[model samples]
Target: MSNKDIITLLHGAGGSYMHSLIKNVFMKLNDNYGEVGLEMLDDAAVINDTVISTDSFIVRPIFFKGGDIGRLSVSGTVNDIAMMGGNPIALSLAIVMEEGFPLSDLEKIVDSIKKTAEEADVHIVTGDTKVMEKGSLDKIIINTSGIGNRPPQLDYNINTLRKNRQPSRWLVPTNLRPGDKIIVSGTIGDHEISILSSREGIGFEANVKSDVAPLNKLMLKLLEVGGIADAKDPTRGGLADLLNDWSEKSGLGIYIKEEDIPVREEVRAAVEFLGMDILELSNEGKVVLAVSPEYEKDVLEELHSDPLGKYATTIGEVRKDISGVIMETVIGGQRYVGRPIGSPVPRIC
Candidate 1:
């Protein structure tokens, strides 16, 4: 069979391949009925100041060290809405399970979903459940759809930053300019590494847990501080794809310092041992922000104060001279970082 004749995991890995699939196949429908729709490719669609996002979770090893698929599903959808600068209000959940699946495990997952929703301060207003033939499906799969409202703080921040210029209606990825600072929330690669360690049973000396948690509260705090131009949570394609997307969309360049980007020592060791690129791994609970230079200090300070962003630091700045992602290595050398074809690790939510 030819390459186009079949579907591969790369098409779902959230990188170049996935982007191509979405643009060529799904986008053909082209039904954009909202402010930011499929064409704009923002975190979520905004309709009449309300934001909505939908996602499906299929991470292997339904239960992992730090969280289960239930937590992952809820956190993923909540973060998507938060990235769009919306305050999540409610969520709708749907689950499909194979026949003979453990009832105890199902109960555990349901309880986890309830607790996570409570933590995010969002309600599970509706849901559905279905059973599949045991041989036709894996253990289970989850889908979540979330609805959010625009917070006044986000509007105030955008208005304050854009003064004379027309401000964006929502936190779009392309709202970047030269001199804008890039800040990442805490460390990277923790989620993917934790998944690998659990699935492959690679017992590293230092225990690493998945950093999968809802970040709506942390995002709200940043909005309160003001001056954020755009925000995104680096997930399936990790930081490389996230940076590349920003550069391509904004028509600008990003210069990031390798030393400034936070990565846990344990995650680094595992990546090196596995011969994988840490930047191409997934992160479930980290966010990347572009802030105006004037508010960079305040934003970083606010992140430092939050429990979820204690390790947050400035990693880079947007540039007008260049037009792609450039990384300054720890040894003082520079290298061009391009978009990956797919994530090095797959099925990692």
Candidate 2:
């Protein structure tokens, strides 16, 4: 069969292939009446100050070291809304379970969902459940749709940070500019590594857990500090994909320092052992922020104060001299970091 005749896992891996599929196939159906819509390819759609985002979780193993599928579903949706500088208020959940799925496991997942919602201070106001034929589906899959209100802090940040330029209505990826500082919430590759270890039963000495948690509160705190030009969570395609997306959208260059980017020792070892690129792995609970130079210090301080961002640090700065993401290696050499065709690890949140 020809390449276009079939669908592959890469189409949903949140990398170049997925983006190409969306632009080529899904954009044909673009009928958005919102400020940020399908054409924009943003984290969420903004309609009259209401931000909406939807996501589906089919992570394998269902249960992982730091969290489960239930928590992943909630955190993913909530973080998407937060990236749009919105205050998540409610979510709609839909679950599909295969026939003969255990009732005890369902109850456990529901309890996890409840606790994660409470942690994010959002409500699960609506939901649906359906059963599929035993052989027709996996154990369970969850879809969550979230709605949030554009908080006043978003406007305040734009005005305070972009006093000389025209400010956009909401935080978008293309808002990055030259001199803007790039900061990551914490270590990368933890989530993907943890999943791999669990699924493959790799008995690593270090206990690397998935860094999965709702980051709405932490995102809001940064908004209050002001000067956040753009924000995104490094998910399916990891930090490399996120940086590439920002660079492409803004038509600017990003200079990242390999030493500045945080990666745990265990994660690094595991990646090397598996002959994989750590930058191409996924992270579920971290965010990458582009902040104006004037407010970069304040933003870092705010991040340092939060539990979710205590390890946050500046990894790079936006530039106009180059065209793509360029990383300064630890040995003082530079190399281009491009978007992966697909994540090295599959089914990773």
Candidate 3:
């Protein structure tokens, strides 16, 4: 290990530690990978114009209310590719297993991965496995690299999401207009709550399941109807984080009707009882689309017809004010919705 400090879990996260690791080791070792792919630091890389995304799954308490790490491993990478305006085709999986982990659990995870790949209509075209000394690794850590074909139209990168495309990777709010409508593809908060329950062993009156599913199909359908300015799954930062990123990046105000934001009643109540902001909660199988105002109804009609999009809701609309993100409170007042404050939840993605 390096002499600096004992690496923590966050190091592997797609944030600072990951960046430092890449600059120090990866970039230094393979100079050719260079600026473009390394700078992106996205879930995948684009090469020869191919859309590629990668993700490492280290979610503890792997087995959760709705799904497990196995399923997450595949969907996470595939979704990352989808976000890039690509159609997922294949994935490369890698696993680091701890010496004492159960064989049965490993099998289950592998089986789940295969199932997910099939459901997403992608294949595990390549992979590698290694066993670590006991206690060398958390039960298991999975890394996946996914490759896809870009939409024939204009290409979109994480650059569009940035506060400003020039300096960093962020959501681009510049494209959003005041009258543009916010459409949520499905229910929210299921993934976070499910994982939270598993981690904390929180008991609930009703069973909560993960909404982790392949979104490639739904994303394709949306494209069939009309062009979408933006499409993000609202995974880690939750819907609130996603919208806030958009509003802040674009310098436009956003108004979201709390009622129209889709949520399962149990999830809403559970989240409310825990005093969590539904907007700040994470989701696994949801898509947020920013569509042109004129096509809002037409898109909504077609989306509603889709079983996956049946729960589609017009949660809000972009605004002309520059106060960033705002919400019409349930009680009829308004509140300045801020990004997530602390570790209210971790490993949300």
Candidate 4:
């Protein structure tokens, strides 16, 4: 648990420990001095007008109710680049497999990767694969890196002093302002619940399928409507972590209503039975957006028009005077919504 120790599962859980690890260990390696850099800790790195992002997937079971590791690999990286207001163009995949792993399973995974790539309209330009000793590793692990194109004529600044300038075409968490609206793309916790069910062999009355899909198309529509201040995919740390990151990074307060956040009845019941907060669970397909108040209605309408964002709703608002995240409970009381800590569920993505 000390700073000078080796890596732990908690460090990969996308929580406080992970953030600290990145800041202390990896952040010092590169001085991203260009226009857009890693210093911001954004979802994707923007270099020379091109957006690039990389992610690794090692989910247990490899296959889930709604998505497999292969699909997750492609969509996860694609969503990362799209969250940065970029158009995903291509991807590269690297895979590590254990000896004695079934070739049929590998073929199924590869087929899924190809299908997802076609669905997302991105090319798989290159790839690599390696096999390890049977006892050296788990069944398989996948790493994907994606490239995207950012608009050339869009403002990237988020300074309030630059009021005369047009709103940024590129979305960043730091772009949030007071009075901006906060929106969630859809129900929370579906993906996590689905994974948990599959892992634990729990059978509920209603099947909880993972909400994992490529969201670049929905993001494109939002960008077309304009006025989007910031956007983040509620992946590893879920809605709570994403909102808390925005609040802490922007030095602004975000107030959300618990009842307003859309959640499937089955997922809610499962969360209650498991005694877990839905906000802390991961979502693979949802985007949390911060939009200008003036365009809030339009943004909601545009989101509703897209199949991916059919359940989009405004769940909160940004506050310049306050800091941190607060949630109004169903009972009319408010409580602090802190960033997730530790690895509540591991190998989730």
TM-score of each: 0.97, 0.97, 0.82, 0.94
Compose the digit string of candidate 4's lDDT tens values, residues 175-225: 778898999988899898888888855555348888989988788777667
Name the better of 2 and 3 by lDDT. Answer: 2
Backbone-clash count (model 1) = 0
- Clashes in each model (backbone N, CA, C under 3 Å)? 0, 0, 13, 0
Q: Write the per-residue lDDT of candidate 1 for residues 46-82, one digit (tens) a residue.
A: 9898899999999988998799999999999999999
Cα displacement (Å) at residue 274, model 3 = 1.9
Candidate 3 weakest ten by summed lDDT: 163-172
Instruction: Enumerate residue pairs that collide in model 4.
Output: none
- List where candidate 1 sits over 4 angstroms from the true fold: 201-206
Sort by lDDT, best first: 2, 1, 4, 3
lDDT of each candidate versus the true structure: 0.90, 0.91, 0.73, 0.86
Kindly report which residue stretches of model 3 are placed more than 4 angstroms away from their true locations once superposed: 1-47, 153-174, 203-206
lDDT at 94 for candidate 3?
A: 96
- TM-score winner between 2 and 3, please give it: 2
Question: lDDT tens digits, residues 1-349, model 3?
Answer: 7746676654543333445666677765554462236544344556665777777787868888778899999988888777655788999999999999999999999999999999999999998999999977888989988888766433333332233224222212355666778999888888887787677655654467888878887776666665356667787657766787677656788889787788888888888788887887777787888776766887788789887788998898888855777888778988888766422665755
